[model samples]
Target: MSIVDALDRVCRRLDEIRACVRWAEAIVREGGSDAERRASNEIRAASFIAACGAMEQFFRAFVEWLCGEIGQSGLRYVEIRLSLHSIASSGDFRSLQSLRERDPMFGRRMDLLNRTVSTKSCSLKVPRDELGLGGETIRPGQVSNVWAVFGLPGSGFEDLGQEVAMRVLADSRNDYAHGRVDISTFLAHPECEPSRFLDRISALEEWCFHCWSAGLEYLDSQGYRR
Candidate 1:
């Protein structure tokens, strides 16, 4: 699909996540079963996790698409695309002297890196998630790296209060998705913050909106719009 199509897909997915959260808000405010877990686990929290995952996947694809647009095969690896894209996204006025500050072992063609319209058979390796997120998939740094590299304005995932909310939602999502123990084990550490679940619905909404807007804005600035 075209980059435009990819952007539309991300927008639509965000809309769906938002709609799901709104429906969740209008549902029975409290319950204990899976269907009733909207107050805690079901659509409210689980869907947020799904939204986060979807956003990461979209950004990965966008990076690859950008690499290909710049005449490289987008197939080596994630960092391969992201690192190259980061360098490419910067302006030609960016000096190699400054770049050397970030890389003590800078031993490449300075002119090629500074050339505005040139392709290269060279690149540097960076931390795999450095261009978008921290170790936590849904934390403060989410897509901020991408935003900076692309010269996009403002915060990405940290746009709202989601830096904290995303963490809370992600951790709770882990427990709900993984920690299905027996009632005896559960009773020992009964997760009893139903109110937090309701609050997370709003958090998840902010996260989804931020991801969509920041992601689309970055892509659009890069010449992909729909």
Candidate 2:
């Protein structure tokens, strides 16, 4: 797809991710039994994986296109790839690597590409265990520095935007996974903070509204949103 088309897809994916997060939160708030809660959390996890996958694909291709258009070396590609991993683990790359161990051709290509682009000095670091339901315990000297790069005016701030979506998904799902509370009690508790699940829908709605405004600003700057 063309760069613009890809960017549009990225934005749409982010929007869907946001929607899924809201729905998952609602599921948690609506109340259900243990089996029901597990089912809901599993669905939420699947949604997160799918949305994150789309975000990663769009981000990588978009970076490559931008770098090619600007006649820049692979540094920007490296930056975008690394930044995209900020929201989750680089499981795709790891899986690819695992496959490459049995496929020499893929291994050769990945090796060459790794050298062509310097991976050092990246603003985004891969999370140690993206699959873990809670905040990972950092090993000694592990840094959790978070940063995101904005696409050129009017494209989209998808790198950070996707991260926000993932954060909510991870947080809410984690709470559900740990049996913090069933959906009914969570919803009934007026003083519950951390949103538990449904308590945070309003906040998510407000966040999305603001995000749309920011996206519009980006599009107007690019002569697209207006």
Candidate 3:
């Protein structure tokens, strides 16, 4: 999807979820059946879940495209190389050497990492784990870091509001997806601060929106076309 479409997808989902929450509140005030109220809450929760998935997919697609552009444009690879190399440490090198001494596979892995980070010939198709952040799955939080690693400036990614909210939303999404949390937890309690939950989610959505914009601007600045 184009950048505008991707952003619209997130915004639309948020709108659906806001309306869903309001519907649940209306049902409660009207003394609707318990099942009806629960269903509304579940729909709202489902909307949030889908929005998170869309945001994550948007990130993956953008990064994959940006990586391809970076590989082909020949604009930022030299800066990325210098930035990556300057951050490398002797201790890191020694650890790699130790891994190589125990198993040649580590040696090969080290060689490939060095080449991929320093060369423009490779696409950003490396595994999510290769980025070296986050636990288990790579949510939008990790994707934001990947932006800086390849595309240079991360724009507002490093902002404390953006970073913390993304991480929190990512973990909460995981819990919801894995069944550790349920819809009622968010909607059943008036004291639960549902608005605060939406605020954090809105923050994450805003970050994705900006990240998409930044990626497009980066490509434009590099003279890359779709």
Candidate 4:
């Protein structure tokens, strides 16, 4: 899928989470038993968790889409950024070493090295594992690292003004998931209210929109090519 499509999916997911938040709001507004009120707070907490999960999925999809686009762009090895070229050629050390061990004749090894150093036309599809998102939470540093893979500056999200929201969402999600904070404690925090959660999530949506636009602009300019 394209980055735009990924963004659309995330937006829809966030909207669903927002709906849950609204439902929780309704429960609070109406007179409710103690049990019902507690349930509503739990719903809000779940919504926050869902929002973080949605954002994580969006980033994963975006990176996968980017790799597919670079592969399809048909640009020569030399035309792309050096970091991408490195990933396309060397990949991880285990794979590279395995290839070397298998190539006693050195023919395959030499050929691979030549491809790396020369301006040969080759598949530039980066493997998802090479992108370094190994089941970790999506933080600002992770976002920056992903951008840096394509020669983009790590400060792009900061420039877009969503860094704090991204950090907060990731950290809060981690805390909740790890049981560092219970739902009641989470709700008790001043910034952890359902409304604040929605606002942070809205900022994330804006971040995704900017990323989509920027990805399209990069493709249009053939930024991957010389």
C-alpha RMSD (angstroms) for model 2? 11.3
lDDT of 1 at 198: 43
lDDT of each: 0.50, 0.43, 0.58, 0.73
Residues 53-140, candidate 4, lDDT per residue (tens digit)? 8887888787777777887777677677666766676544335566546555376556556665566665755455555454566788
Q: Write the per-residue lDDT of candidate 1 for residues 1-226, one digit (tens) a residue.
A: 5555666666677677667665665564543466564343356545646666655555555555544543333322222334344454343323454554544324344544343233434333334444553334544454555555545547665545566666665555456556554323432332223344445545555555555565556545643211
Name the regions of candidate 2 deviating beyond 4 angstroms: 33-36, 70-226
Tens digits of per-residue lDDT for model 3 on 42-156? 7656655665665666666555566656666554333444433322222344456556455665665666466534534333344553454313444544665565455445554
- Candidate rank order under TM-score: 4, 3, 1, 2
TM-scores of the candidates are 0.45, 0.34, 0.65, 0.84
For candidate 2, the lDDT comes to 0.43
RMSD of each: 9.0, 11.3, 5.8, 3.2
Clashing pairs in 4: none
For lDDT, the strongest prediction is 4
CA error at residue 16 for candidate 4, angstroms: 0.7
- Candidate 3 lands at a TM-score of 0.65
Model with the higher TM-score, candidate 1 or 2: 1
Each candidate: how many clashes? 1, 1, 0, 0
Q: Which candidate, 1 or 3, has the higher TM-score?
A: 3
